[model samples]
Target: MIKHHPSETLLAQYCSAQLPASLSVAVSIHVDMCPVCQAKVAQLEAENAKEVFSESQLSSSTVKNSHDTEEVDFGTDLLNLITADPSIDEVYEVEPVTIQVNEHNYELPRALTRISHGRFTQVGKLARSRVAIDDGPLRSSLLHIGAGGEIPEHTHTGFEVTLLLDGEFSDEEGSYVPGDFIWQDGSHQHTPLTKNGCLCFTVVSSALHFNKGLSKLLNPIGNLIY
Candidate 1:
């Protein structure tokens, strides 16, 4: 019963490999958890493949008479590229990785398991683990909110994307469960809180701007903590 999803435009960009690494990873993790999005991505990929095949066929037809040598087989070349590694076995498997926060353990999504993440940095009831992805100003991390934890009301200077990995959380907007993909920009501001606790995968393009009284002082170290 996942309600939030990446926009269709975002999904298209993801299918075409047009998004930045951090955003792409966020969308990928969402697709891993959402069956609806998984099917949509599959359809988009098929359509893209069809278009590429059609263009390749047209190019091959136009060059058929001009070449004296045998025509290169693109499909064979692709197959060779896929199976070029001699050490690759007939089967491959990857074990899931788990993270611990406040004595609670949660398994990471398959997409995240492939990437490297650093140690967690704790600040009161909140903890954040930076994901090692170099995408210029875009920062990615795993944010864990312990029970009764709450983030101060803040607006984004650029953009923020959060994918709920486990548990539930709520804001001025509404409650979000696991697999919810929440996107926010400078126009939106809210304080997020969890009752039972929650773990989220988040990516931020820039530092946050706290709106409340004393919390505004945290604006300087927003990027470090979030």
Candidate 2:
């Protein structure tokens, strides 16, 4: 069987609708592939059935945009704060370096074109997307990680959610195959590269405040066009 995934608690929080859409989708894909993470998600969901959804689970507004970047360190505390039940003793999966081949293929999928094709006039090809919440800027994204693509290492201004519709990926978190979901608070940074080349689905909130200067090169033609 495939190895465990990046984090279990993070994924659990996402499925329970505790994390932001962006990060929630990421963690979700991870859990889909790793049974360990899935189990934790199930447990968390059951608990939430009795308990109210945690507000602290995903604090998107606190991420601090370019204007507030100074006030927020935007480092560490990347992951959201969560309370896991003691009964669920599963361990979080470690991030993976090389993604699994043949895990899935968004590269060849046409249905996904609907999402990938959408671009903002300035944003160009949207590498990220967000859920529309009141005018609060609480956003999320479905990243178009291309085959053999490598997403740069960036820290979160808020939370990040990723879902692997096709292909497999891994980072400091762990390996994620298709159907896998991952959740990350603020403290996550990893460069992901596909092995055999495949497409990946991801959702992220509080757009990653990229520390690296590759933004220009990363987007190039698609920059802000989306």
Candidate 3:
């Protein structure tokens, strides 16, 4: 059973394109894992689509005005922008971008560059590459992360999932060793530091929204990673 099914209202909102970017990422993951919730969301979308068609007198029902489809229309229509630029459909399922992130070779606080890291150190080495940025708009032919060594206390403006690759890190949440997966929603905050100079792999949707004060300091670095 899905432990956290987003509220029905939330699922509806997501289907209606009314959720935040980061929370939407988390909710999509939930739908991938939970078929029951997925079905419900799909049904809601179908109903909305049907409503749209019915208003145009395109209903399957031949009876006049027998349909109870609600009228829901927005003021200004948002256009679906699509370009035939041959590259538009170029979806990237690139090889997991790698990171060597060892204590000996690189200096502390260096951002990991995909081109720099050889084909050897794969991205998210510890856990299965579960969460990845597949959103079509994100520029993914190249992805980068800072080897800043220490991640400060932070709260996600969206969902943050980390998979320890070669080293370990710990915070108020718990100690995460290589292979252990950690995920945090928008509501939780924690300060994480590497205990043994670890190499970590992480995926974030939308930037982390730091709390305040100290968070201001973190915003620069944290925003860079996401």
Candidate 4:
């Protein structure tokens, strides 16, 4: 069961295609694993459709001297625009992509497999590999943390979103299992630990800022690693 979820505002932004690409991907992947969020997104979409239809009807009633070429099908166009992107609602069991780590293979979330290009780069001494996906304003990665691994206590400068894909991990708040969506900002700081290991898809707008201990030394070079 997923204990954490993207807020209703975030889900509404996702439904309206108003979120940035990286954040959008995070929400989409969460929806893939969480039916509750999926249903919420669907309801938002329906409400949007209703608003568009109402506006279209009002516009059509006020139109005068309209030519065939000048007239536009607002409802059709809006519906197409809303539903055209399969990333939001498509079922992706046709072609699954898997990545290997420490002699073990893990299947990536469908939303991630589309943008990862099947590449992972090793980072740190722990069993972790960061698969990069650039999304303009945000930096996205697929992070794999092996058993007993820990991410040093750190805070964020901007915003960070993490979507758990496999296994379990715990932090100051609680333990997060697959499909859990965690959001962090500058004011938050915690060390993430995995007992049985876990794989996560993460999006960060800025490099993580380590708050204490020896990890603070890496602050100067954090951008290179985070």
On lDDT, the candidate that comes out on top is 1
Model 2, residue 49: C-alpha shift (Å):
7.6
Query: What digit string (tens of lDDT, one per residue) describes model 3 on residues 59-167?
Result: 2323322376544233111112234255658764435443333223322121222123223223432112223335542311111222434545678776765544444
RMSD of each: 3.2, 16.2, 11.5, 4.2
* Candidate 4 residue lDDT tens string, 105-195: 8897777665644456665525544445556768777787888889999999888898999889999998898999999999899999988
- Which regions of candidate 2 are displaced past 4 Å? 1-34, 37-136, 170-175, 213-226
TM-score of each: 0.89, 0.44, 0.39, 0.83
Error (Å) of candidate 2 at residue 58 is: 34
Worst 10 residues of 1 by lDDT: 58-67
Model 3 error, position 8 (Å): 19
Tens-digit lDDT string for candidate 1 (1-226):
8999999999999999999999999999999999999999999999998987775674574323245665645665545645898766566577888877779999999888878999888989999999999999999999999999999999999999999999999999999989999999999999999999999999998899999999999988877755
Quote the lDDT for 78 in model 4.
Answer: 47
Which stretches of candidate 1 lie above 4 Å from their native place? 55-70, 75-91, 223-226
Query: What clash pairs does model 3 have?
Result: 110-147, 111-146, 153-191
The candidate with the higher TM-score, 2 or 4, is 4
Using TM-score as the measure, which candidate wins?
1
Clashes of each: 0, 56, 3, 0
Q: In model 2, which range of ten residues has the least summed lDDT?
A: 117-126
lDDT of residue 109 for candidate 4: 78
